[model samples]
Target: MAKQYSRPSHYEQLMKKLQNDFPGSEPITGLMLIYLKHIVHVVETSSDMIVKIVEDLHNMEQEETSCVAKSKILIISHDIHTRLYQQWSSRTLDIVEHGIEAFDTNETFENLIVDLLTQLLKLAVFLMKQPKLNLKNAMDALHEKVPDLLPQQSVVHYLLEENDSSMSTPSEFLTLYQRPFDTSLESDMVWPIPTRLFPYN
Candidate 1:
């Protein structure tokens, strides 16, 4: 007979506590919280896996292990690397598609999406380097390269500082959609004629 597995009591308790702390009152806020939880889970899980792989590599090197054992370890490490890469790519695409939709209609929400995507991409790049490189050097390079992934201050800051009186709040956006167009600007106008007439002799 196979043993049935269950979640740990502490894990369940923690989940319940988090749910209570962050109830879904606003859609964007709830979505952001969900994304945070997912990113954290991926980072912790990938970090643990990488640490284990690194330890295994160290042990194999110290013991002068056989080529077969070393190859097996490398294979396992490669598999983990591939899995993590796939997850990052999928998540990136998902974030980008959602961001595009929000960008088209929801200005405030689009900013949040961009920020969230930036953080996720940075974390993904950091994790991607762990399987086959020196951790400290990889992180140093990553820190240097991070600016390339982020938006320039001129772009995002300009959007934040610009005072557009026409910008709509969420409630205003809903009301604007529901209301009919005025069409006042479409009315025709008359212009005065010039009074200069030439008298020919």
Candidate 2:
């Protein structure tokens, strides 16, 4: 679906339809970005309109096709209380040069999305920071931004990796695989009250 929306004709078609349907002449203020399948859509509308826009998008997809990949809201990467880029606009991603599939720098999918975001925001900043929603201009804008940007903060920043070493023992990452502790009921209440830590017990 991301690839489908990347094409100029398809992109334009959707944007045009959205504009006509909603009929907003307002400059984009808020973003509801949903990332899936290597695509992050930072939908630029007011906060109120975001859910509507998302619903509309899904409806359009369902109308055309017959299935939906994911539901309306999953903030893959966002700080909802804060808007990261003031100068950024909608619909500016160069999937080719900044190829997502080729984004194999030992990062997780969640982190890769953030990396893509860095490139996108930097691109918006590069273009003297304005919304240029034309085709060649959008493409041109994307390419220009790519050369100047780097991954500002990658997933590596957060994770505590140990010396490129491999572990022999099984990870304790999962807390439980057994029945936490076995429970037995001899009677409704045991005669010699066994020790229990919490009052809830």
Candidate 3:
């Protein structure tokens, strides 16, 4: 007889809980759950794309590829970044329409938003550092297209220039990102719980 697995994986349990708790009966809860699910899907898909982009970059760097080819890769990366920002902006709007009070009461829901924001910040930083991708241009586009997407003290502001020497590690980045939220209740209310992204670190 085959051995039986008694324990469900964390992801499995989380999915089961989500299905049980948010059954799409109420309008607001259903909308929030749908937005959260979309956000998770975007993050997962974008992460996989980023990994592939990084691997391609490595190979191109090894081959000393032509500027045109590198430019094409940069364009693709920028497009991915834009799509993520748009998705995040849509999610934010969904939350705002549903009201922060709705989410603030639920610790698990708040934690999920925090996790999503952290992943987005990390991805943004990673993409910003890629060669030939103009960070300023990307920010300008986001500002024009999704002006209310990010708060005033967003982690995007902490992104280092290619020549800057400070805060190379992700931990350092998180520290810089968390400083603005330490005393601002308004910021806290508007955004997710700003803390270290990696709990184990």
Q: Pick the candidate with the highest lDDT.
A: 2
Task: Rank the candidate models, highest lDDT first.
Answer: 2, 1, 3
For each candidate in the order shown, give its overall lDDT on alpha carbons. 0.33, 0.40, 0.31
Q: Compare candidates 1 and 3 on TM-score and give the better one.
A: 1
User: Cα lDDT of model 1 overall?
Assistant: 0.33
- The backbone clash count of each candidate, in order, is 0, 0, 0
Best of the candidates, TM-score? 2
Minimal lDDT window, size 10, model 3: 28-37
What lDDT is obtained when candidate 3 is compared to the true structure? 0.31
Q: How do the predictions measure up, each by TM-score?
A: 0.22, 0.40, 0.20
Residues 1-201, candidate 3, lDDT per residue (tens digit)? 001111223223433454455565311111011121111212222333334323433343345332212211101122332332212212222322323222222334334345445554654554445454564455445535444443322121112111233222333333443477547556568556677667784
| Sliding window of 10 residues with minimal summed lDDT for model 2 | 166-175
Give one digit per residue, the lDDT tens place, for model 1 in 74-188. Answer: 0111233233232211111112112322222345544643564565556566656676546445434543555455333233223333434333322333344458875554223
What does candidate 2's lDDT look like per residue over 29-130, in tens digits?
432221222233454455434444454455544554623332322232334454444532344333333243333356564565456567656644554344
